[model samples]
Target chain A: MIPCAVTGIGQTRYAAKREDVSMPELVREAALRALDDAGLDFDGIDAVVMGKAPDMFEGVANPELFLAGALGAAGKPMFRVHTAGSVGGSTAIVAAHLVQSGVHKRVLTVAWEKQSESNAMWALSQKFPFQPPVAAGAGGYFAPIIRAYMRRSGAPEHIGWQVAVKDRRNALRNPLAHLHLPDIDLDMVKASPLLWDPIRYLETCPSSDGACAMVLSADVTGDRPPAWVHATAMRSEPMLFPGRDEVSPRAGAACAQELFEQAGKTPADVDCAEIYVPFSWYEPMWLENLGLAESGWRAVDAGRTALDGDLPINMSGGVLSSNPIGASGMIRFAEAARQVRGTADAHQVDRARLAMGHAYGGGSQFFATWLVGTEPPG
Target chain B: MRPVHIAGIGQIPNVRGDTDHDEVQLVQAVASAALAEAGLHKDDIGFFCSGSSDYVMGRPFSFTMAIDGVGLWPPKRESHVEMDGAWALYEAWVRLQHGDVDTALVYAYGKGHGAPVDGMLTAQLDPYYEAPLGPSPMALAALQARALIDAGRLTERDLAEVVAHARRLGATHPGVPAIDGPLDVDALLDAPYVATPLRAHDEAVRTDGATAIVLSVGGGGPRIGGIAHCIEPIELGLRDLTAATSVRRAAAWAGLEQAGSIDVAELHATYSPQAVLLRQVLGLADAVVDPSGGALVADTPFVTGLSRIAEAARAVQGGAVRALAHASGGPCLQHNLICLLEAR
Candidate 1:
């Protein structure tokens, strides 16, 4: 396999609604930024890869076809990937594969979601004929899983509140984050309304309209420093079975395990991580799943996941701070790249050399992850 | 990079409406058949990928449910594409190049008969300009057909001939619904136009179906010579509708010129005129085209593309030396993919 590196990264300012621009314009904003950051134009790109959660989110099926011109992908190999919420991370990984496989030298990948166009909750809760109806939205479905985790781990309720406050505060430093709560605190999070049992309104991710893009190349070609991709992995399993473990799903663990093994590294070598934390409790659940912490809630209670902690997680506020659904995973991946490249601005982890990005989707059945470092792999 | 081959292919008979089976069952039947043909168990498969659309199912994350058919007890490496399954095959091909996985399972399923497929396809158009106008896929294809006629590049007789030939061949394939009437060119030309310059015979037959293909590295099957795809601009006004420039570019990239003479060409031409247009663009004058009747007879959404490649591989398995398979997406062939296969 050929070596691949991320040379450019761009993100849109996430918000509940981006009414000023159309979907094409919304994606073009991030794509143009990525191209400019790479010190190249559309002519330099060899192919384009796009991803989104589902076409129903925006009432547009196969949006990549209409977006071909907007992405400057005319007369180029354009591809679209969809794997539920993990689509963004998978999109980036597919783009990297185009480079790693020696098929294309320069690849531009983008993932975006315009949630304002349609109600994602309603779209997700649709009932089909001869199938069980979805009685609850995403939060309602995951709340019981959180309850299971709390019972299994015997963790205190305060762990969820603490995560909410920490991530929101971290969002204050990220200018592009959707929610910048300077006054966020444990008390405020505890006082927030309870949308689902064991899950609070503030603990949930906000639905935002945003996009994220990256320019990957076989060789580091941009003027900026490159974050060499050490390894990438994706895994999937059935959504439900008789003995499936909803908490700490095997697919996610296997994905992360393969990722680290390929990179020849361990959790200790990872200085920071950007994980998919749609809800506050998932930060701890995923920490254990990724093998970042032997006792995930214990790590959070000990302040080990704090911004200044030994292994700072979600330094750029993560999916909790700004959730665009589809782009959230790529945001995690891009933030990890930013940390290792020393270009994370105010959210930069001090002397960060190695970082990890992780995402999961579809009842925690689909998983995608990548490990990146400052130095190229041998 | 490691060499990849089409080890096996599986497809269910196309039907207008399959009320008896759900997406999972449809996928399971074909996936099992393909794996059985490859002589491999689920444990031997290293990766899994599928192509599907949410609109066809009228639900989000529809592909998630299809994984149950593949069985994820050990949690396999998996991904999906929103486009045709042909693109999914391309992705699996690229994944094989990493040399970590030796075999991959690719499948696609669609229930187009459950909904107004032509009207649903309008959602693929530009939302700001075209979708609001509500031009059905047939309408778009008719416009392209009209442009070809105005350019003096094709006539209605030429289209009728393509449809006539496809119908005669389609009658022999069990997967296609048997045609009941005369298949003469004049008879096809006399049919009422569903859209201007395009009769019902000119459009693809919308059906519900599923398809699966197994790809392996260094396996005993038809070796993949070259595989590449390209896309054209979205705006219809900007392109010369008489020609398929993207198809020419993709063919060049796939080393079509260096592949020497082609023995068979299976094209995913959703419309009869496209088959004529592609034949002219790709310059396949001597190759046998659509030996399995192609998409015109059984144009199952998302499955037609992969079925074309499967048919091409089957042709090679039957002693053909070299073959070409083409899959297309978007209105009027805005996106095109070509896979070149040869006997090992």
Candidate 2:
């Protein structure tokens, strides 16, 4: 595929709650900010692509129809994608294809969630016939998987806590991060309420109401100092089967391998990463999946993946902070692009040239990833 | 831009209710037929996109269960849209434009038999303002039909002719339920008015069905030509529903006449008058239209529009015609899509 670029990025002030604004207002703040960041306007955008988790979460059958007016998608070619948790990344992939295909010059991509609007756990529980009724929240479904991960990798128990603490501490620097735990520490996360045995309430992502947007452009049409899209890829497998590995699915691994292969680089070339970490343990879990950790060894040892460490991960406080389910994935991609464009303020990795954005959803079976670089890739 | 094409097309016979077969079974039949037509295997495609609505399934993530049809054993890079299957084809086209994958599978299914089909369409209405009225799609379309009648572009006999030809043609076409021939226009206009002004014949025979199409970049599929899609706002009050916004929008985007010319045209017009409306809205000058009876005779929910694209592809692939195909969605033809195809 031809190289696409991310020129502008925008995000709302992540908070425990955003009450005064409607869902569209929350999304508009991010989109307009992205337009401003990209130095472009509505006229410059040729099309729009929007993504979110599921329509049921918002109580709106098709949230895209309602959001059409607010997202400035009145007449232009507009598309809405729902790919479970990976929708945010999928949304960006769809938008990037518009530019890469030369179908649209500049495309506006946005994903958002008003988790405060509805209970996701309840929404996901609306079951049908012939399906398992194990809808004990996403964490409950993954706790057993985490146990399997622990047995397979022989990693210690404290690694998950390390991830929660590092992400919370990093929140202090990102102005847009939702959960800014100034007093966060290892003991605090361990002491937090245990929602699911292995996943603590504090370690879990908050039901945030926020939005993220970005302006993706072709190389020739890029207006701002663009985060040249080095490579983008996505992969998915069935949600469950006899042989499917829930903890570390082949889909996520294949997605990562393809991401780097398309970029003509390796995981070591990545300077920072904004990975989907809805729960603390997924931090180290995805580390090995992304090929950062040694195979079968899934812990961020050697003080890596920290803000000051090599391959810093989730400097935006990640899903652990502001996890507006649908927007969570796009936020990761937007942050990576921001780093490549050298526009990341407090969370910026110093002299970072390459960054990665990653997301997985639906029983850890679906994955979307991209590698962005400061320089354009041939 | 790489020339995109339709490598394969498949469809299930649109039935009122396949009581013996479920949605998954229906999807499987269509997928197998399309792949067999193109001589392609499931693994040969890199991207898979499906279109269906949760409202129709009466459950969320409705498309998840339908994957059994594709035999997605190893799992594939797949996505879904809460819209018509025609839009799924559009999404596939956009992915190919990125110049990444060469081939894609686009499929859609509508379970009209799940409940009262007309009641299901009520979900498309505005929940706050209009849905409370419980205006069934037939009645709502009748409103627009009234406006067209008042304007004198059509008369009582014209409506009947559309239905007569549609059903008569349906009786001969395979997969179409045996509808009888040549009802009177006045009789149709007076068929107790299911809503008002618009009669039963004005609407297509509602049925449960599934359809699928295989698309390739650079016209690499069995058939070839131009493919384009453009969508309008969801609000009917926002635009003139009486006009064909989708057709005009799609025609302009596809550069309908700019490219080599169109020799044939097919559109998803569930309502009889819609065919006439699209012809004028798209300014399709004397194209060989709907030789297969089109949507008026038998409209198969979300798959109807994509069926039109497949119909166009089949014609070109069979050396029957060389031209463009159009599809539509939304209430009273709110959204429109146009694709051009040619022979090798």
Candidate 3:
């Protein structure tokens, strides 16, 4: 594979509703920032790759067709990657493949979701012929799984509230984060309404509108230090089937294993990670799935995953603080790159040499993860 | 780039509509057929990728249910694209280049007859400006046809001739629906015009179908010489209608010059005039274009472009020396893909 690096990263200030700009403008905001960070213009981009959760989210169809002009991809090769909620990370991987395959040198990849245009809850809950009418959309589907995880791991109820408080506090450090509750605390999280049993309203991610973009190039060094890509991996399984382990999906575990093996590293080598924790409990669930915690819930219970802990996760508040569905995964990826490049302002991990970004979707069946480092792998 | 070969190709015959099978069954039949033809099984597929549109199905996450067709029991490594199936194939080809996966499964399906086809296509336009107008897809194509007519690029009779030729070529392929027999240019011109300067026959015969292609490295199949794609701005006002600049750029990137003499070419010309413009842009006047009637006869929304590559691969499998396949997306040929293939 050709040596590729993340030379530039960009993201918008995520919010519940971005009524100020159209979808194109919202995406352009991030794309322009990434291009500027790369010290390049449209001329420097060889191709464009876009990713989104679903067209129904924005009442648009095949958005890339309309977005090509806004993305400065006119008369250039462009592709749209969609693999459920992992689309953002999957899109970045596809763009990186173009460079790794020696097909294109510099590729621009963007992922976004403007959830304000339409009700995603209704769209996702639109019952099919054989499917039941599940209420509350994604939270409803995942609530049962969280309960099962709690039961299986015998974790305390305060664990979920603790995560909510921790991530909300971390959001105070991130200017672009959607939720910045300065007075957030464990007591406040416990006081919040229980949207789903074992998953409080405060623990759940809020629907937001946002976009993230990155400029990936092959062996192209810019003015700033590049986040050298160490390894990237993706895995998927059927959303529903008999004998499937929904609580601790084998797909997620296999994805992490393949990623670390490809990078010639292990969980111990990771200085930090940006785990996709849309719900508070997912922090522990994914920690176990990624093999980062030997005692699973006990690891987070010991405060070992705190910002100042041995391995920091979601220092930018993560999907808990800002959940733009499609852009959420790419945000994780960009944050990891930021940590290694020492560009993450308030949330920067001191002397971080390696980091990991992760995302999962479709009933936790789809997974995409990547490892980035301050130095290129030998 | 590592050499990628089209080991197998399969597709269901295009039909106006079907009430018997769902999207999953359609995709399954073609994928199973293609894998069997390649002498491989699901276990041999190192990577899986698909292309489909949610708007076409009037639902969200359209490909999610169809994932059953590939059977992710072991949780296969996979990805997806919302564009044409040809783009999915493009991703698979790129994956094969990584050498971690020697074989890839690519599939695409579109149920064009599911909704009001013309109106559904309008949703792919710019929501802020173009979608509000509620312009049917034919009306947009009409604008392009009018420009071609005014530019003296194609006459009404020329359009009719192209359709008549496509009907004849389509007659030999069982997958293409039979049109009224032996249509002459004058007879076609006499037909009612659905859009100004574009008769009913000028538009592709709308159908619903699915296609699958298995690509592998160093296989006993048609070797992929090169594969590339390009796109243009969506706004018609910003582009010159008579020129397919994206096609020209894709052709250059796909190494049309080094492809040598083209024996068979499957061009995805949903509109008859596009066939003319693609020929002009690619300088394929002497080449045999669309031996299986092209999209003008059996166009199946997202799957049509992928079917072009399958048809071209079939030609190379039938002993053709060199073949080129083309797929176009977006309005007025705003996006284009070209694949050059040759027998090993």
For candidate 1, the per-residue lDDT at B337 reads 98
Model 1 bad stretches (over 4 Å): none
Candidate 3 local lDDT, A80-121, one digit each (tens): 999998988898999888998898999999999999999888
lDDT of 3 at A68: 97
RMSD of each: 0.9, 2.7, 1.3
**Cα-based lDDT for every prediction:** 0.92, 0.77, 0.89
Q: Per-residue lDDT tens digits of candidate 1, residues B119-185?
A: 6789888898889999888888898999988988789999998888888898999888667566899
Best by lDDT: 1
Global CA lDDT computed for model 2:
0.77
For model 1 the interface RMSD, in Å, equals 0.7
lDDT of 1 at A270: 96
lDDT of 3 by residue, B1-344 (tens): 78899998878888878777688898898999999899999889999999888877767888988888888779789998998899999999999999888999999998886565676678889997899999877788878878888998888887888888898889889778767545688888888888888877888888888999999999789999989999998899999998878998999999998778898899988888888778778877778888899899988888899999999999999889999999988888989999999999
* Cα-based RMSD of candidate 3: 1.3
Task: Identify the superior model by DockQ, candidate 1 or candidate 3.
Answer: 1
Model 3 / residue B143 / CA error / Å:
1.7
Among incorrect, acceptable, medium and high, the docking class of model 2 is medium
Residue pairs with clashing backbones, model 1: none
